[model samples]
Target: MVNWSLKAIDYEVYNGVTVGDLILVFAILFIAFLIAKIIAMSLRRSLADKMKKGEIEALVKFVYAVVMLTAIVTVTPILGLNLTGLLVAGGIAGIAIGFASQKVVSNLLSGLFLIAERPVKIGDQIIVGNVAGFVEDMKIMSTIIRTYDGLYVRIPNETLFTSNITNPAANSARRFDYTINVRYMDDAEKAIRIIKNVIEEHPFALKIPPPRVFVDSLGESGMSIVVNIWAPSSEWTDVKMDLLWKIKIELERNGIQIPTKRNLA
Candidate 1:
């Protein structure tokens, strides 16, 4: 109650901001913001030009945000604001945000590890759990996949890190095994020769390893012959589907009949 109005006027004169100082502070802030923007743009362009798509894009965006925030923090003190209070508030807010976004942070870190390790890459065919698809895109939080049946799938990075990955196409070569059953009365040796010939004639089959046909089992229905062949991984599907048709046509041409089961007593 001691002359509050008089004290207010006196304080204004003693420690008040001048118009010129205000303009200077504003100009500095503006210049700093412009500089930060330019740096961010330059960094973004450089990273985009050099890095792969998806996660790199997310990282660049995050960097830009950090740069802008740093510029604002640097300019705040110049505006006569309480920096200690601002920092304390920022710390409290960050703690809250961190707690709320723990899962998101985990995903981001997992994605970073994925990018660094390169266990999988774009265009690679991978199977995770029940999901099998080609990797279409990857980001900090998730990866996109396009299934063989034209379905789109989004899998979280955290899940990827925890799950098992089966990359069938990782290697250049893969093996295919076919089981053929022939009547016990049929000549097993003759059937084996015909099966080997069929595999050798297939254009997609790799000739280096050579095709192998062996009698694996003699079941109640027929004699089971196992045919194993090596082919390039890229041509696995085509070779698998077409081999049976080619084998059937060749067996028919050679008068090698597959025996059918009759009713038993």
Candidate 2:
């Protein structure tokens, strides 16, 4: 014969929670939260000291999310939550979120590649598409540019990856080419010699490669002479403008007449 009362007594177990145990569990969780916060702050300070400002910002945000997640996991068992079940749920949620944020993830990865490659850096002058500006800030999603007119432009990382980037200041030397049309009647050889001298005398011009002046072609209007000069990249624009003005002034001062519409006839 089966003893039902004896079987019931054997199966019974003490699994009930007490007030004191609950208090201890809560205290442990509180302490864990505080410790996580302290550790996160310390990590942030260390990373900030070694990394770029934009990189530090991203790293700090990641650390904060991780710290909060760890705290949540530490407290889950105390709250009687099944760890395995929670993990399964979390995995499914993460998959969904990842799919939805695919573009965001792509941009972030592209931005990281840009920073590592350093094709362009902060304060570099760049021309992307029709936009020309100095790089002000580089972030995970996009880059900020301050235009010459004081306008702020936000360009996505994806665009930068695909477009042609013109970095004028990438090298220390740059070339300036300009054409001057003078009357065929004037001494073309003398004019060429004079222009070469002017370029060589310029303070901004480079002497290594030397300046060049040659007759480009005989146009319908006049004789075309091309002037090519090399200078430091930093002085490119200023040198180009000043060279043009100086050439004009010197040519007129030397009685060298520039071709006009009336000369074309």
Candidate 3:
């Protein structure tokens, strides 16, 4: 019939942190989490029209992280954990942990650099090392990309920061080249004219840079005609797919044929 109360537990302390201290720490953490969520919601609502999704997300994440970190630091004294003594007591373990966390620190710094440098933004089509995709989001430790085939990939920020990044979409215009082979007997000049006409018909093709179609080389089976086209960076893929087959069809309509093994013979 003894009554148990929080006051009765206050005298009992383990490792300098009482049971009440643990409860208070948890309570503070829960409140901090709620505050962060509320702040994030408010930020999204206020910034929805003023910022892009990625920018808003980055801002919200940064704020939330700061709030959580502040909460942890504020409560550390209540937990009575002695960082100095712990480090001194476990010097070897500390070194091992530091070594293991090197990559994490590297990723964090790289992410910060990416945010500041902005070589590629969300929705940008980019090629990083062997990976090519549209940037989905930039997180604190990693970047998310949605590949052309719609597969999701997560790349460590450290890797992305160190890799060669190719962002064709960063420029207003993009160029793509194609090599079309015509049968040696067909008119290479007429083929070039047809290809040029096809490029001009496409809406996305740039007239300023001007398309180039010329006889590049003579292959064993045919004459190699190179077609270089400049198009709006945003529409280059559509322009490429639309114009390539059109050029082929128009050339065939005018009696020019792609060289095949049988055609070569």
TM-score of each: 0.69, 0.68, 0.69
State the lDDT of candidate 3 residue by residue for 119-162, as single tens digits: 98889999998789899977768899999999999999999998
Best candidate, lDDT-wise? 3
Model 2: residues >4 Å from true position, as ranges?
Answer: 1-55, 63-100, 263-265
Error of 3 at 208 (Å): 1.2
TM-score rank, highest first? 3, 1, 2
Give the Å shift of residue 153 in candidate 1.
Answer: 0.7
Residue-wise C-alpha lDDT for candidate 1, range 56-146, written one tens digit per residue = 6667666566666776776665456677866687998888887878888788778878876778888888999999989998777888888
TM-score of structure candidate 2: 0.68
lDDT of 2 by residue, 53-150 (tens): 76766755765666667767776665566788766879988888888678776776677677667788788889999999898988767889899899
- Pairs of residues at least 3 apart in sequence or in different chains that clash in candidate 2: none
Please report how far candidate 1 places residue 9 from its true position, in Å: 29
Q: For residue 143, give model 3's deviation from the true position in Å.
A: 0.6
How much is the lDDT of residue 84 in candidate 3? 76
Instruction: Pick the TM-score winner.
Output: 3
